[model samples]
Target: MAEQPKGRLVDVELDDTIGRATPDVEHERNVAIFDLIEENVFNPAGAPENGRFKLKLSLVDKRLVFDIRNEADEPLVTHILSLTPFRKVIKDYFMICDSYYEAIRSATPQQIEAIDMGRRGIHNDGSTTLMERLKGKIDVDLDTARRLFTLICVLQWRN
Candidate 1:
């Protein structure tokens, strides 16, 4: 059989300068990164399939940076995406998240479920936005995009 695609990540790091996370946000960040490292398809355009890519996420001057490198820390390709496209969705997602948290504390189960549903819908929208932004720069499945989107939001943390 042909070998499986070697387009995968070995490690991922969120730059400290991007900002700190609360305990809960930290948990989500850890889960998202762990899940991403556990399974993903990260094939950056023109990168070799030697299978030793590391990813560093950070924000500089409000721009999102995807610092791709090899196991030896050799630079691969650095994609700095503008936060412009994500501004609205991220804002909406955070607002809905607030509502979801409040609903969990006081609303009925059905109410909580409804808010959570809306939260997931906004999350999906973020994922789609990310996928579109990464188009032609890197290739990732929906699940991968979703995880990355979570990390991105975590970097911009509210809680």
Candidate 2:
């Protein structure tokens, strides 16, 4: 069946101590939240098409938690995913982001663009992995998955 408009996400937030450290990741967090809320398909498996659902994302015990709720704030279902599958891609993404950041400071524009291309490639890899892992648990489009992956990486940020 075609996805309904009510299947879209309205709100997204972080749950607890998981927070962003770097400025780049902070910007990514804000952008991800904005992009998700503005327009994104996010239908939790078997959940009704309610346009007012909210999501509280978090990490605990090395697991990624998707705390979903209805318009009334009633509990829906919490999907827990093991972080093991995301480690390598996230690490590669971080490394490329670090290179992009440094490139911004000293490298030529062409060099910066090259690093950014690699960064985007790694980001795509992470998003694809996330979509695969979320299979049978939640339904999301590519844009939605990409934004969600960015948030996941944001939660993994540390000093």
Candidate 3:
């Protein structure tokens, strides 16, 4: 379980904490909590070339839920759920640019699976959901429970 820092979430940013260093590397090194809040960011010029999808980051009780809206105009296009193409592009883009990027880009399937499993563990502890464990079982004071829930919700897993 991640430590519940003694401050508000809105007050913190990765850049402020790590200065000019690569935020992803710093995060990996420190095992920091990461939340990728990819909102519409209002691409009034219009969404991505592949159309728009609602990417919401919100507090559900204390959990930061990644609500991804799946919408596509073409059936021939593979669905975004697999995320393989997205992963490929990210890797290819970084691979062309920097050697350091290799660490992040060339992560083994085992590493990816472990990351996914960690998230699943947090979200699904055996038969009990994370929300249930934090709120109902894990022994803690009322305030700690409230804050811990908030922390867990906001921490997200991403490519």
Query: For every model shown, what is its TM-score relative to the native structure?
Result: 0.91, 0.92, 0.20
Q: Tens-digit lDDT track for model 1 on 1-159?
A: 995455888899998865666787889899999999998988898888646689999888898999999889999899999999999999998899878878878999999998888999999999999999999998888899999999999988832
Q: Give the clash total for candidate 2.
A: 0
lDDT of each: 0.89, 0.86, 0.32
C-alpha lDDT (0 to 100) for residue 149 of candidate 2:
95
Ranking by lDDT: 1, 2, 3
The candidate with the higher TM-score, 1 or 2, is: 2
Candidate 2 C-alpha lDDT tens digits along 56-133: 999889899999998788999998999999999999998888889888999999999999988988999999999999
In terms of lDDT, the poorest run of 10 residues in model 1 is 16-25
Q: Which one is best on lDDT?
A: 1
lDDT of 1 at 6: 56
Whose lDDT is higher: candidate 1's or candidate 2's?
A: 1
Against the true structure, candidate 1 reaches a TM-score of: 0.91
Which ranges in model 3 have alpha carbons more than 4 Å from their true place?
1-104, 126-152, 155-159
